[model samples]
Target: MNTPARSRITAVLPAHNEVGALPATIASLRAQTIPPDRIIVVSDRSTDHTVEIAEAFGVEAMETVDNAARKAGALNQALEILEPEGFVLIMDADTQIVPRFIERALQEFQDPDVGGVGAVFRADPPTGYLELCQYLEWARYAEQIERTGKTFVMSGTAALIRWQALKDVESRFGSIYDEQTITEDMRLTMTLRACGWQVRSPVECQSTTETMPNVPTLWRQRRRWYLGALQNITEMGWNRVTRRYIGQQVMLALSVILMTTLIGLTVASYAVNGFLGVQPFWLVIGAVFAAERVVTVWDQPWPRRLFAALVIPELIYALILQSAYVGAVWQKLNSSQGEWAHLGTPHKTTEEV
Candidate 1:
């Protein structure tokens, strides 16, 4: 008779002063349909009650004294304690998994070839204008990854990894989450791909994270992300999978370049034809941007979804992100080392992360 396989799963939540969101995140894990065999929360130099809260829920909590790589360091410390033969999940403390996230994510691991599974991250409940914009942008990003049929980056917000793939990654980088890079998720994706491990994000494995409350914080965050992306690409070298993703980013960069060209053309038009040349270009751009939004936001409600088609907000939002991309390219060109700055999260009196 064949023996039934036991679910040897360990989940690690690396938190640094994340008291506001930790309670709910822990509660969701306890309520998982396929509950993790063990749940560990690593307190990464936390000054608040992150460890206490984890202990309160009967979850094992370990504190990291002074490891440098931030989240990556905390996670590596936790992984060392967890058994290697089991599957492991790394989740951001601010994120809350959908009710059936474990059920949905585990379904993908049955494939054996799938080494890592990521969740489709959504904003918890966007309250402000910028928050809503971020919501729409994330929804579109989730849609794009799903359509591509190959998810390159398994978000740091939520990802489940098979033990073997973690081993493969550790063998290459000395740590599952590399301390050498700010964007550990992207590096892990490249490493796993090179090792012939499949990574994916199923729509059903939905999760949510807090959005940056303001534009400045959002800019800083994205600037780091894009800069790290460029660093990873340059460091990893263009391979088959990385090439496809890089191609899209390169096109996005070109769009930024194209906008500059458009501005110059508009000036030339003013000098030659009283701005007549740029009007045609403006009309074409308006139609295309509107149409793009309409298609992308179809799943959203009516008027709010209609906002996706609006010229001003949509263009302004795109410009902000494009500016971040431009900033990233400039920083990368200068060999500037980037930092992880996920700021503007809700803070309690004790000041949570």
Candidate 2:
């Protein structure tokens, strides 16, 4: 068992109509090995039973009348009312933590220089095939976090950020409450780095959260994410270049663009070959890529992992979605608009607390 230290820890959950999942998420928090000094839930214009549910859990709840700014605004509002001397754990109401997650994260912040830390996030299980594919994608992400202490972005689902770090640039980095763009995580990460802080993911801190379960939901999520990335790249281009932080962003952007082009070309080539009554070399290339994905997913079970390994289909879908998102991003950039379209509702699930 981990002993609670003298250091005060505040857990903040920015919620919006999260009544269905908040109960389990709060239960997991109550079961934490190191109980938080304060548990605050920021209710963002929730028309549901969110406020009542949070009261039932006995957590301090504050409602925001003007939720025009979305999550960042909700979080900042909570921050304004909380004691800022200790660490702040920013979590989503849809996620549940392992017993040791907060304890482990607190220990990591003891390093002093660490500004923020993220956890190993697993998408909720017993989902459909598409959801399983998302889980595999998250698994790969977790591996990357373990391999490199530096993560390009931190998931809001389970992130422990220093209060001082947040306060330093919270006001300078634009309106925190405005719901513009889907890439708030990336912007926050960049802001921290700009303030001379490092963010990391400790392997022991684990959290499970739901993922989009179907192609349509997945497409919308990815599109918003891509759009956010593009907006961030444009807004902070100079900061990124001067700080030498654009390398990874550029590489990822290029990779997505290249993948999209390759897939489109391959499809066009196959169609032309069919018309000309000849075999296409593009088919051979596609087969080789598919084989690589299959080999990559080989460590897992037969059909599920194999289905997850289908690189071509996934890449093609990503390209189409990202292309449309990029267009939306460009529109926002040109018009100087900084708000995101709410993608209806997010899928929710729970794991053992």
Please, what are the lDDT tens digits per residue for candidate 1 over residues 48-164?
Answer: 898898898899999986798877788888888777875788888878898888778777777878888988889867777898899998889888877876686888888888888
Estimate, for each residue in 234-326, the C-alpha lDDT of model 2 and write its tens digit: 667676432544565566568767867866876887798764333578668868877766655555678755675567556654555566556
- Show where candidate 1 strays beyond 4 Å: 1-6, 267-285, 342-353
Worst 10 residues of 2 by lDDT: 344-353
lDDT of 2 at 121: 86
Each prediction's Cα lDDT score? Answer: 0.80, 0.70
- Cα displacement (angstroms), candidate 2, residue 159, comes to 1.1
